[model samples]
Target: MIRIAISAALLASAAPVLAETHSIEPGDGAQERLQEALILAEPGDEIVLAAGRYHITDGLSLDVDGVTVRGAGMDGTVLDFTGQQGAGEGLLVTSDNVTLRDFAVENPKGDGIKSKGADNIVYHRIRVTWTRGPHEENGAYAIYPVESTGVLVDGVKVTGASDAGIYVGQSSKITVRNSIAEANVAGIEIENSRDALVEHNIATRNTGGILIFDLPNLPVMGGGNVIVRNNLVVANDTPNFAPPGNIVAGVRRGTGIMVMANDNVLVEGNLLSGNPTAPIMVIAYVQPYDDERYNPLPREVVVGENTIEDGGYDPQLDGADMLKAAFGGELPPIMWDGLGSLYVSGDTPGWTLGLTEQGKGLGDAQPAPLAAPAPAADFDETGIGAPAELDERLG
Candidate 1:
């Protein structure tokens, strides 16, 4: 009897442990069913959505660690939150080791999908968008991951955000690749974040193509070690329609890429074209904020081997009038605001802007000192930074 019991136990241990799968079909009360599944889900559970549209009124949240929520495909499975009332986001994830894939979320009131304070989260083949065109009332961000570590956003498409399309803020070890962002205020913004790689993405017709920014009064202050390579940023001449109080509202239109107040950033091997403003701009975080903890300088920035074409045709001479005046309204491929005190080459105390090799059709690099101090009125009226508020809300 003991030998038989031992053999049975060994067999049981050798069998694979199967995770529970909760499948939700498209029908009335589907959102409730999804919420119930999430409430009852334990670790290693999988929630699968059917290949149809689910009209969700309230936002859905998943807090179970090591759980996966997937759909049939990005095109087949749709979560439409057009009339959402209860939640500020379509889906909120606050669990570790979570994977969300193969789904489309649309038209949330605040943000499309947000993951907060989670580690090892993966969003793959997911689409978040507004069916309507770009408007200020659209959600602030699509596919936003904040204060999270080991996050990967791959093969995603985002559009019609009032702020950024794919925004990764205050996070570490992040990667956003093979993504498409368009018709947003700023596409693919990495703010107050570190150790990120953004590559193989296409950003077009946005206010600004890609922005690496570090704002003040955030828990995560300085951002560094970011690489943006092999991306196509073109024709980002959409007018800035962000709400008046937001910081991105100050972003000039027709800008291809803007790097503000970050360190150790590299922009290389990208194809940029047809931006009316400058193709690449490097400037300090000159906003008037009283945060002593914030480092406002951008250091160790390398702009290497990027193909630029037909830029500086009609520049948006909004904030930096000095740049427009100095370049005679025809800006160069790369424009740097000489704000750094560190010496780069032979007694020239300017920002460490490096251009190793230039591509064809790019104008000369124009690194000039700021003509005057930034005006205090240029700061956004919203006193508290949005990212800090978002962090508090996520917490």
Candidate 2:
């Protein structure tokens, strides 16, 4: 028999390829058995999403590259896209070392777990929610990663995202840690990313709390070697329900930790409280672009050492009560707009807007108070975050 059929084809090519799980369960067809186990997963498969509530009507995709779509614990595996009749994202990963753990995803009409160009991705403890909280047709982003490199968003817990409840665009080696962005408009956004690492994290009632934008014509413009440390930006006074020509509807409600137009950015040890529009904001990307390789300013920015409280009293600017009686009863937790290159180390108490140009707005005001100066050395923490083997897949 030809030597027993060549030893059964060399014992089936020397057997050693076991790597499957695929336990998907949850009533009825379960969206065709969870999109047929993410299209018959291969490369080290593991699509176990079994623990109830999966009424997803439409969106669900995965290109499969080292798959691992686990579940059964981001509040017990819910995935109920409130009868989604289409797609945009309710789970759309384009493959490459994927690992979206402990799922939840509710009401995902448009973005609630999107991972494009997904590379070394690892969004652990995922829980994108839009339980009708902050609406504008809620669902802009709830853990939406884009154009990846090696991103790791840990312990996720987004809520009501009208635009940004943990959104990382463009992307490079990124790492948005711990995580818990609430009432979103922009609660944790790092647009046009680069070597990023917004640490710890706990942005509250979001309108804008932790945003490091570098805009100008997209396909990824020069963002920065970013690193916003130890966060807990509080009381982000939500109200920017974004949905009108959205760009976070010009986030303002109670902005906190916003650094527009990046470069070697680094804001440190945070814990700002009751952020009433300015619990640390450095600007200059005042929009008016054509992207000649854009450079809207914010260079070498650094505002270290923080633990501020009762920020900017209640000033949603445009001369709010004469700047809160000229910074006596409020307004002062660092708010600069004087076009970039900022650095205010300790004794932090600021104010600026002395804009000279760049899409001039605030009525071209000259607010003044933030006398910056401090960090001159030791700021460069090379190659920022997200690439320590993506934290061993959040084991």
Candidate 3:
């Protein structure tokens, strides 16, 4: 029995490491090949996608576990989505234990890569771009994650996204590092997630450079996060306009890194500087739950060790006065946006009223006056910008 065991161990140790590298060319029936290879792959398989443009209209869904999707680097491999449907979202995830590295996903119409209901996913050395020369659509986001956990998004360069360069919502246990979110809607957004760590990232010239929110109205909750040691969050307040569903609607015209309704969260050791808007904004909640089909109030939020560099000067949307006027004195650092909100900080019970949209015409409960007349720009980036333009503070 000892000799048999020794032989078995020797064989196991000497087993050949076969990592099948599948190739997917432009018209190589890449989808079909990928499915087959994924089924046959073991723990250490690599699907090598070659240098070419893969025209996927509906985008790709990656669900296989313990697999790696390798490409010919960001410069060589491209998933070009110039025009597509379904909110322009590309590469949705439904499984866990996935690793996608060294590739570029260009979805001008939708999100670059969206992972939903996934865990233990790693996106490394990836680049997502939506800019061709000077013309940039909504680079919605390079990485949009929802209902995911244990994620690491690193060494990525995202440019020219319309909404947010990287929007992470309803996720937990995440880390974003050594990445760049430039000239997009929002550089980095963590909404309704938990146990997150955002560090060593560069955010520049997107609406709300780095935003974290609880958004209790999302039917999801947010908390337990940290933003530490980042650099160059600047020039995000462009107010470059677009219509709803135009991709740009979600970004490129708002505060820098809006944080709302989160707890156990810390903003420490960050070099947030030179933005067109406030460098660091910690909001109380999403507010006015009536619009999102739920109550939009926030609670149990924390702020610490943050550096707010300015564009904080707005004649109409004066956050300081708004806080002092509403809450007697000294606002909650960050409060919820909009004039239609029904709740405030230090609340114990959740909202009792279900979300209703009946008050749109009735106007804000106390509209915030407009800073200036509504430019032909986009208002979605700043929920209160147009409201401020309307010369009204709903809060």
Name the candidate that leads on TM-score.
1
Candidate 3 lDDT, 110-201, residue by residue in tens: 67888887777777778888756113445456788778767777778887766667777787777777788876666777777776677778
| lDDT against true structure, model 1 | 0.78
Clashing pairs in 1: none
lDDT at residue 203 of model 3 (Cα atoms): 83
Model 3 lDDT at residue 95: 71
lDDT string for model 2 (141-243, tens) is 9888899998999989999889899888988999899889999989899988899988988999888888998888888789999999988999999889898
Candidate order by decreasing TM-score:
1, 3, 2
Measured against the true structure, the TM-scores of the candidates, in listed sequence, are 0.82, 0.40, 0.68
CA RMSD of each candidate after superposition: 10.5, 15.5, 12.7
Task: Give the C-alpha lDDT of model 3.
Answer: 0.57
Deviation from native of the Cα of residue 263 in model 2, angstroms: 18
Candidates 1 and 2, the one with greater lDDT = 2
Per-residue lDDT tens digits for candidate 1, residues 1-395, read 24345436655787643577889998998999988887667667799999999999999998988888989888989999997988889999999888888999988998999999988788888999898979999999999999987778888899999999999999988878889999999999999988888889999999999999989998987897788889999999999989989889978888887888887777777899987876877777756778888888777776656777755667776434555556565556665665442112212112212322222111333445423222222212222112222222110
Highest lDDT scorer: 2
- Candidates 1 and 3: which is better by TM-score? 1
